[model samples]
Target chain A: MNKSIIELKDIKRNFKVGNEIVHALRGVSFTVREGEFVTIMGTSGSGKSTLLNILGCLDTPTSGEYLLDGVPVRAMGKNERARLRNHKIGFVFQSYNLLAKTTAVENVELPLMYNSRISASERKGRAVNALTAVGLGDRLMHKSNQMSGGQMQRVAIARALVNDPAVILADEATGNLDTRTSFEILVLFQKLHAEGRTIIFVTHNPEIAQYSSRNIVLRDGQIKEDKVNEHILSAAGALAALPVPAED
Target chain B: MNGTNLFKIALRALNNNKTRAFLTMLGIIIGVASVITMLAIGQGSKKSIQAQIAEMGSNMIMIHPGADMRGGVRQDPSAMQTLKLEDYYNIRDEGKYISAISPSVNSSGQLIYGSHNAPSTIYGVSQDYLTIRQLSVEDGDMFTDQDIQTSAKVCIVGKTVVDNLFPGGGDPVGKVIRFNSIPFRITGVLKSKGYNSMGMDQDDVILAPYTTIMKRILAITYLQGINCSAITEDMTDQAIEDITSILRRNHKLKEDADDDFTIRSQQELSSMMNSTTDLMTILLACIAGISLVVGGIGIMNIMYVSVTERTREIGLRMSVGARGIDILSQFLIEAILISVTGGVIGVILGVGASFAVKYIAHWPIFIQGWSVMLSFIVCTVTGIFFGWYPAKKAAALDPIEAIRYE
Candidate 1:
């Protein structure tokens, strides 16, 4: 029997602008089992980001229910929701929202600061470990200003993983990167998935969704399709296919 | 949130905006400094005045006769010879609270000692006059009781009189001085006591036995006024009462009548001056306190700006598990830190200002420990009170909306 880690039932979000009411999300129902790598694809204003925010515990559904690890999240208090977000959910934004003045290691340690169980030294160690997992171990001290767009995204990924969260929520994590950098970050996501971490990635690009084990397409605030991808790309396979760089 | 962690975060934020934080604290600094400095000046002036009064003799009391109306004309009672030697003797004998008493008679004339002559006052007083007025002999001895009994022509000259009548440094003691051509031997010289508050030269007079002036010079049996000393400051009222009763009996005044003389005690003057200075001090402090309120408002303005600027950070913190109370406490701590730091600096500045006033302006300044502590506490409270709203605004932000804020 597969244990479902996240479940959404007929979730809807309505926004009132002046005199008009806009439905941002409507009758969206979905479920993901443990350790599943799922990607939701959609165009701009397609409600994919809203769905990601709701899944990340950053926002509550206006109607219906959201369950994380079989626990009702919609009815939780603010502190409870924050605790849930800190312990089980981590988010990576499209803009790579790493604090501007902080280094990669410090950015990664941000999530651990919210978790009191970890000592400062241990938090640093775990942050260094997360940065190493994202292949930025040598650039731990480099701030976001000193890093490229791809590197900054990797730092954000490291921050999302540093807490050892149950699920990683990435909202267009590679939307700002070039095609080559996008492939690299997708490979990193695949690597993280291989390590038994569940990930829900939101993207507008179909080529990026090909790296995930499963894909869900959203359109007009509703789920259009959900399917398993037989041709999902593995990180090691993708890396092997890339041409090796010559030592300068 | 743990206090240490909150403090660390507060310190970091303050450090991040050092100049802005300092400017926000400037109001508190100036307010506290001014309060402390003004209180010091006020207290110092009060203390100095008290000291001057005490030096003039804390136990001293002056008596002035009431006005006497004669034949539908208001006359100066002092000129009417209302105060008498018998009344002085009655007060001295009947007043238990009085330590000493002396009757006085004053006349201005040229005092001559061997062709060197100068204009000065001649005061006829009893033996207790020197002690009552806190005067001491610099040379020889005071007039003897024999001088009073026989109405002898002998006197004690003050320092300025001696300097003028005997300018060549000869011994004026035991030497005869001519006052209006009346030969009087100088028996002693009084030590210098600078000018009194009324601009009278305290050490520029010659003192003779009261009987000498009454029988020989003025040919009067009454006194111009009486000077007395109470045993202690607290006994002044009792002494006044006793002297008033004795004088009323001596003067044969009827019951239910006002006393014919007014008694003024040094203690009353001291307290009156002190209260006036205290009121002035409080007024100055109130004026300075207005600046503290303005400073608090400045802090509120800056804190409000800071909260608005860090809305995204607030959202991030809330999303990461910080409660509203946690955010509120953090901001409050930051404000308090600014105020407390400013207060400390202000205290130093106040002390420096006091010293500056003392040395440069030649004014008395007394910095008290309590004033510093009080100002510091007021500053910290101002910071907390003023920053509370901004902190609450920051705390009350919705995490979801804040995180998504552009």
Candidate 2:
């Protein structure tokens, strides 16, 4: 049995919105083992965003125990949490948040700047490898604004993987892409998952959830379903079966 | 993150938007330039005045006859002639730290030599007047003691007088020049000293013996003023004290009675001019310093806008393991870089402007090293001081909210 990299026990989050207590997340418990590709599915009001924040260590749960790689992260200070995020986790946002006008390789090198042990040469090598892993080796000097949305997303993935973290937390990783580009990104995710990297993907679309090894559904601030995916789909096979646009 | 990396990031960000960075630096550049240039002008004028006064002699002192306090009005010192030749001789023989002494009297008259004529002041002074007043003769010789004893009508002409009375460039030495219808033989031609700080032509006078002026020209027994030099510049006060005591004893004034002479020293002239120039320098600096404050505010304004505009960028950096202090330092470094770069350019421009004023505008300008260093330090401080609030606001931002900011 694989050891769990992320374990959440009885997590609760509350927000005071104009004098009324809105329960964003209520007693949500889940464990993500190492090397598993898990998809968290929910609607806009389902508290999945709150849960993702807690998992990414960007926010602390009001009442819960969060063990990230067996270290208690919820009790850590601000600086300690930053350290944990640098070494233990990586983030992929839907907006492909690469600095505009910055080259691809330099964008990939951003996270390693916060890592002290890595030398400049080592950081460059790691950045090149991460970008190559996402099939952007030839576009090393391409600026994000100068590249397509799909290419920009790949650069963001390279940034997330540069630190070789224990977990990758992606929120709507392919939400901004078209059908074909989304499938291509999902294929890249499958490849990273095959390389034994733990990924927690959050999406509102059920179609994206079919690619994960495990599927989680949240409703009314609680988990409605936490089950293994019985019929795992291949994003690459899906991409290949679709008809290419004539303009492309 | 380390400072090097943080600075590199800031430099890169600035390099990306070259125009915006330069525009921001313009304020500091103008501010520093104005401050240095103004100070240079004031300093240069002060130095020139000091030099002119030193030419008059730093260790020298003058004794002028006391003013006539008549009832409710006081007449000028030149109208009174209470000093006598006996008092001048007594101070010369008995005063300590005395190096040179001369009795001086003056009268203005139209000078005529051959066909050329000029109106000039004829100064009555002894042979010691040349060395005590730092005067040198370009031709012939100064009047002698025998001429003073015999009351001879011999005069030494200055450069302006020579140029005016002998326009043909002929030697005026050994020639007779008529002063108020009296023929006086010219003994020497003084060197040209040019214009003084007050714009007065310094070389527009003639020197004669005091005995000739008192016995022959004006026929007066009293003296106008006594000019004396101290052995050294530092001993001028003691020299003045000694001269005052000797003159009071020789004149036989009562214990509580005031002396009938007033004293003037070269130091007084220098210090009075120094204070005036110092006031001008401070006023100029204060006015220019206002622009510096405005420049600092410009940096603050831009940095604040930068923090607001780069909210998502801040979020991304925070998520990638950058601490609050790290974000703060990055923004702070950006501000410092702008101001410091501006300061350097401002110094270059200010020094250039000083030279330009000195050469092109014909204005005196001295650029002190301390002024440049002071403005440079001010620019750096302005960068950090004004950058603090914006950087703090950026550092205190919530990472989650910042990432979500549009």
Candidate 3:
């Protein structure tokens, strides 16, 4: 994959907290090419969340040149930014953020409601395809409250993919799950990565970084490290090593 | 997002808290209901007064004997005996505008018919009194001109007198009912006239020839009052003017002196009643409007609460590519739906309540179609007006801050 889906240059963000200037991101810059599985690692107050917010188009950098698939994001108007978020970027939250009591297919169809070009039947069809792609074909009718945490996350993933966005951004996607369930979700990400999907993961867990193709570590509002993970952890291999579940 | 889909989502959100939604709508429902009911009551009374005026003969007039003032006190006109039988004759025969006339003499007495007895007032009038008073004989026939000339003992009994004299609902015509020990044959029975607004039973009287009543009952010579009717409702004032001029010429009263006779018309009573009822309707409608305002405030309060409760939902929708206008429209639609729904329900309830009052409570109720339509329009405006603040608040929220809100 030669094309870059996201590019940032000298992205600076500051805030005034009671006569104090807090620099959340001090001129950080990076580029993530298409089809890359990149993980951004940081501890608390490292400004990774702020950086993710800018990437998700939920916030704009105070002064920076940020581009998503060659479109200038910082200069976009509010409605334009919203349209970009709807069509290009997909988000997966640590809490899964799947609408409670909403069926998986319905949740997946949410993003399509904003896309007026899509017909109702086409929207439903695409939602089903997306859920099936996330290995949740049988759980299309299942609501978040009725599903296990892992299953709910999968439903959230289906929601993120339903619009066929250019890049999928996950923030602490496995932070709430146990070790076995984390690996199962990570393996699903690996499968998606192998299908030529661009994925950006943000987490504080160092162990999770080893599973991605590249890692970028942030320290004190600046990038401290950026390199490929030479010894990649195979999530499927890790999942296979765990003992089989006992029948209920 | 499309309006239909946005409203669908809004409807679903409201459905999530069914009890709250219903409670919120109660305010509007009550407001609309009170507005409709108050207007109906006002309209109903106005209509009833008009009906009474029509029943009293719209074109009719009354001439009362003017009272003789003793110092600052004016005595009853009936005791003055200024109106004479000749005035009634001249008005009936000479006046072009006058259609009918009857010299009236009133006497109250206890009537005895067989073993049954009733106390009723007697009115002495000629056959033309029926048309002048807008009364019709429902049984037998009216007394002839010979009855008045010969001072006949034939008389007509009104519905209440019939009910009292004949308990079994038999035809009272040709039956003898003695008034003050003077026996008279019932010549006819008048149709029922129901009761007046003053709680007076209008059909509680018996009618006889004025000459007979004056000689036998009251032992008087002069007529008490003269009942006259004009050719049409509009001509009543002219007929009264003609009678006054004719009476003044005959009585030979000086131009400076006050006349001894007074001419009255149903229009005077009608206008007075209409103005009184008009003031009452306005007063009642204003009071009812206060309830509608209270209902609107309830809507505003609930909408504010709803916006606060659904902060996270608003954030979610905003983040999902919903523009500020989209968020605004969603919340606006929610408010409009609640109010319009409430308005529709209130209309049904108000109409039902009015009907119930009319049928069960035996009260007059006139429901104006415009009032129902007005309530609908008012409620819609109320929803939009009250919902605007909360909807704007929701639309103006910071998506990130909202998402993080508990």
Candidate 4:
């Protein structure tokens, strides 16, 4: 019964390649409601990146009626789209694209810096809160290169959450981590979702869909299947089940 | 984003690569420093030359017999006897702009006192010659008008002549010095003036009444030249015009005929020297300015490299909600900070170098306030002009491609 946070009707994206047109996305339809954890799954060349770009407001559909938080995005200008991206959506990349040599809190404060309404003190407070929420309070002062991959990913998540966007768009947020760290990050995501935050997790790995409330699988630029999971798995339980590695 | 935040961002980026930033600024530093130093030296020399001219009587004018074709052969002005004592008297009586006037004739010969002798020129002139030439008697007295009226053998000796004719450093006054076998009693000694920039020894001269040279030594009725002083430096032209008319009237020259005399003023010499110095100043500044432009290119080069190196960072910032203008201003601000900071340091170094040159090289140096201000404005403009393309390149980058750049 929650309001739709994202709506897409027959979205299509075409690319021109050396005198030929390539259809990247063909007539896709989907809606993500508030507080839903939706996992988008596809193989390589399955148009998941193009779909992610569209969902993140980085790229527009060639033809579609797309709405983000009830605002029609088809007619928006580039700058307006950038503003929309800043105010409504937060992005987390697979590589954890944090500024080099910057501290964790500073990385988290990056998103809020663009918002003129947020004062410096308020930005710092919000960044602190976000880092604490992601369980990185003790690591707030650690530089990006100083932290482990999982910790860096946590900082990226904190950055995403700092703006309090309507939806957090994550592109393989845990792809670079080891099994235990990936599960740990997944547990953090589930925790955030339980707190009523909307998230759209884009991944090529099918195993990640079991942890989310809904799944949309794509193949060759078209939707192969779309389903709501009957039961969501607990990432913390999965982490506990793995055998612990011996310390060096 | 606000300018302060952008400035901080720019500062932080520069801080990350301190060595590269400082190296890039070195070009501007050398450029600005050399510019200031060269200008100071140029201006300093020009001022010193003007002071020397002023000291020699700024309002002084000289009239010499003109070169003319006599019997189908061009004759030297010094060889011509066109300037006469009658012309001198006429200008003295009728010229309104003249403050002082004197007829001049000289006899170059060996001067001797006992066993000492030196080759020098004895200038025969009225007492007004001393005032017109800015000469002051350091000791004894100047000759009286009675000496000229009677054509008495009295003369003043300059320092060099005194030194040569009285090598014992004894007083030359009341001593008799023989000029070309003609003996004359010394009435005064001129104060010493050392060698000028042109290496001319001003102190090596003798002065006596023109009538003494014309009637007693040279045995001629025509005068060689006339020296006059205008009422003021600004009245030199009017004085020359007045003297020219009087001389023409005395000579009874036709209306369209050229004069048999040439008139020259210290103002004209001063202007000629000034033009020469100004040309040198401009040439030095132009050479210095080339290095500044090269320095600006250095800034552009580094900015381009910086933009390329931070492509991913730019993408991340754009991803985080920074607009294109924000990215542009950030890089532009960084370039500006580098140039302006270097400019300030250059100003300090330049001033220090000017003083160093003055003390160490013994060269005159004068620092103008306008040079410093000019460097500041030039460096700022250089930052904007050179930094623009690179910053624009950074701003116009596609966020997706930039983020994924290897």
Candidate 5:
């Protein structure tokens, strides 16, 4: 009975590559309810990136009915889509795309900079809160280059959470991290999800599907399987079970 | 995004590349500095020239006899004695704008005081000649009307003449000096004027009564020339017209005939020098302006490189809810900040350079407020003009491709 935050119906996308129409997404359909942690899994050439882009409002499906937070998205213009994306979606990339040489608090403040209604002081307050929420309270003033990969990714997550978007859309968010750091980031995501935050994590790694409540597998531009996992693995439990490494 | 936030973002980006930003601003700095310094030099020279003309009596007018065409043979202006004492008297009596008037007749002679003799021109003039020529008697008194009435043998000696004829440095006043075998008592010593811009010695002269030069020396009935000063500098043209008409009537010239005497004023010479200096100023500014254009091109080039280098940053901002226009403004503001900062520094450096030139190089320099304002506005415009294309390119980028850019 939960309200659907994202609903895609028969979404199709085509690209013309040198006079050949290549189908990137063919008749894809899904609905993600509020507060539900969903994983979109696919191999290469399976249109998962295209689906993530459409869900993030970075791209529009060629023909589809897309309702994000009950607002139709496919009919919106480029700028309106941008505004919708700003207000309703937060993006976390695999590379931890924090602005270089910028402090964590400032990087977290980036999303709110686009919102004119927020004053500078309010933006700083929200950024500080978001960073604290991501367990980066002590590293608020640390620059991106001065932090490790896991710390930089946490800052990126802090940026994604600052705007209080309807859904946090992560694209292979922990792909570049080592096994231990990946579990640490996954644990943070699991914690955010437990706090009733809607998350749509897209990746090619099938092992990540066990951590989410629902899984949608894409194959050859179509959804091959959509199912629910009754037993969701806790990333925090997995991180604690790993052996402690020798001190460097 | 709001302007200030975008500005802060742009500022941070520039801070990341401080060395590159400073190097980029160097072109605009040199260009604006040269423009201000050049304009200062030009204005300074023009002012100095005008001041020198004012020192020579800004409103003084000279009436010289024009060359006469006699039976297909042209007579020299000095040989033509059309300007007479009658014209001088007429101008003094009828000219409403005339403040001072004198008749001039000169004879070159050797001035002897004891064993010292100096070759100098003895200018025969009335008492008013001192005011007309802006000359002052430093010691003793000027000749009175009695001296002119009696065709006085009294004279005034200048500093050069004093140094030559009275080498012993005693008072030249009341001392009799012989000119061309005629002994004349020196009534005063004129103040030293040193040399003029033309390298002419201004203090090497003797002043005697015009009547004496016409009767005793040249033995001529007609005067050589006349000098008149207008009541004010602005009344020079009117004074010249009045003198011309009076001289024409006195010489009995017809309405259609040209005047036998020629009139000239210091204002004419001043305007000529002013035009020359203005031309030089414009030429220097134009040359400096070319460098400004080059500086603008340099901005465009650096902005392009910055856009290319920060593709990932632009993509990240866009993903974080920044619109295309926000990205564009961020880059544009960065460019403007560089230029405006350089402009401020350029203005300070230019003013400093102008003073340095005035002190070190001994060249006159005047810093005009408008010139500083002009360079500032120009540098701002240069920022916008050169920053547009690259910012547009950055804004139009595809976020996906930009994020993936190597």
Candidate 6:
């Protein structure tokens, strides 16, 4: 019923391999409303990654229109597109993509650096608040290499949430995490989604897709199935089951 | 794109690779040091020459015959064939500022005293020539006007000729020495003067009265040259003008015609030598400056490689909303830091090296403030010019591709 936050109409993307053109995406169309928790499912080479890149404004589609809110993405210049990517979209990669030498708080503060409107001290304060929200309050000063896989992912999530972007586009965010850690990340995503944030998760794992409200399966360069799932896990329910720590 | 952030990032990046950064700065260091040291040496020599020339009497001027001959033909006036003794007297009488005037006649020949014989120059001059040249007798009396009028065979012997002829013996004054088979009594022993700035031996000549040299030693001679002095240094130009007018009137030369002879003052010679040496020093410094440019190119090459190596980092920054100008500013700041740091170090080393050359090697060295500032400016410019293209390439990188780059 609400206006679509993202709209892609007959989008296509192609890659050149030597002299031959490889179609990464072919005439795909989709729309995501605000506060929607969606998952795109596909095996390797299914163009799910390419779709995520376009959604994040990191790359342009070869043809067709991609409109974020209302502005046509393909028509934006390099700097304008970068601004869009910085302020409108947040990305989570498979490897966490945390700067190795930087602290968790600094990693989250990166997006705020590009926003000239925010003062440096204010940006740092916001970054700290984002880290606290991700349950990384105690580990804000810890570096990526010092933290565990799950903690690093939380930091990456905090980084995604720092700029208060309209949407978070994640590509196989838990690909390197263990089963237990992946579940923990999924629980965090659910909590973020419940807080009125739009999330798009791209992964091949069926278990990961079960956490989202909607699922889209891609085969080769086209979508094979698009459906809504009513049985999505709730972060509050999951958190209530975990053991609570005693007050210091 | 703010300056503070850019500088912080650049400094951090350079700090990350300490060894590579230092090595990159080495080129500028060597270039600046070489330029400064070479220029110092050249300037030092020039200053030393000027000082030596200043020590020679400032008012002294030399007039050589046929000096204005353009090609190979003589350009003297018809009547100028005789630069007579009477003409010298007339010029002395006419010029107000004229302190002394001497006609010089010289020939190179072997001088013998007992078994020791040394080849040397014989100069025939009046008593005024000694005062003009700032030469004084050490032990015996000098030639006087009476000596010139009487055509006496008295002479002044230089230290070198004395050492060669009279080894460790007594003073050679009053001793008779044969100069080219002509016997002359030694009247005075000139005080020791090592050499002129041009490396000419000033202490290896014989001096005698001009009339005696003209009539007795080198017979049938007009005049080889004339040496004159002004009462004061400031009056040198006026004295030269007065002498020129007197000579022109005596020679009956028209105003349009060029003078037959050349008059050179010691001050003029000093200045000319100074400028020549200054030019030579600057030229050497410029050649050395080329090395700094080469060093800058080295920095550029390394920066390009660094950009390629850190493509992923560039992409990460771009994704975080860093503008191309921010990236450019960061890399450029890095380059300038390296060059400026190297320049500061190079200036220290250059000045130190110059002092080392001066004290240890005993060579004259002069280092100017302008040279140091110039080297610093050169170093900074080199960094920016050399680092521009690589920084531009880094800024232009595609975020998606760069992030994905293995």
Top candidate, metric TM-score: 2
Q: Please list the residue runs of candidate 4 whose C-alpha ends up more than 4 Å from where it truly belongs after superposition.
A: none
Q: Fill in the DockQ of model 6.
A: 0.38
Candidate 2 chain B, run of 10 with poorest lDDT? B1-10
**What is the lDDT of every predicted structure here?**
0.85, 0.91, 0.87, 0.90, 0.90, 0.85
- Cα deviation at A48, candidate 4, in Å, is 1.1
Cα lDDT tens digits for candidate 5, A1-248: 88999999999999999989999999999999999999999998999998998998888899989999999999988778778878888999999888888899988998888888899999999999999999999999999999999999999898889889999999999899999999999999999999999999999999899999999999989999999989999999999999998899
User: In candidate 3, residue A33 scores what lDDT?
Assistant: 95
Q: After superposition, how far is residue B139 of candidate 3 from its true place, in Å?
A: 2.7
Q: Is the docking of candidate 3 incorrect, acceptable, medium or high quality?
A: medium
Cα lDDT for residue B156, model 1?
Answer: 93
- lDDT string, candidate 5, B1-406, tens digits: 6788888889988998899999889988988998899999999988887877887888999989988899989888999878777777788899989999999999998888788898999999998999988999999989888988888899998999999987788888999999989989999999988887567898998999999888888999788888889999999999888888788888999999977888999889888988998999999988988888799899999999989998998888777778899999998998999899889888899899999999999998888999999999999999999999999999999887787678
Q: Where does candidate 2 stray beyond 4 Å?
A: B68-76
| Between candidates 1 and 4, the DockQ winner | 4
* Local accuracy of candidate 1 as per-residue lDDT tens digits, B1-406: 4666667667766876789999998988898899899989988887887777887888888876867666979878667677888788788888899898888888888887777889988888999998898889999999988889998999998888877877789788889889998999989999998887547788888899999888888888888888999999888988888888888887789998767777888888788878988998898889888888898999999999999888877887776667787789889999999999989988999899989999999998888888888888899899899989999999999876777678
Query: What proportion of true contacts does candidate 6 retain?
Result: 0.34
Order the candidates by DockQ, highest first — what do you get? Answer: 2, 5, 4, 3, 1, 6
Task: Decide which is better by DockQ, 4 or 5.
Answer: 5
Question: What does candidate 2's lDDT look like per residue over B53-162, in tens digits?
Answer: 88878788999998767796987888786799998988888888989999999898899887778899998998888878899998999889999999899999889998
TM-score of 6: 0.82
**Considering DockQ, which of the candidate structures 2 and 5 is the better prediction for this target?**
2
DockQ of 2: 0.76
Give the number of colliding residue pairs in candidate 3: 0
Q: In model 6, what is the error at residue B193, expressed in angstroms?
A: 3.8
**How many backbone clashes does every candidate have?**
0, 0, 0, 0, 0, 0
Better structure of 1 and 2 per TM-score = 2
User: Chain B TM-score, candidate 5?
Assistant: 0.95
Tell me which residue pairs clash in candidate 4.
none
Better of 4 and 5 by TM-score: 5
Residue A201, model 3: Cα distance from true site in angstroms? 1.5
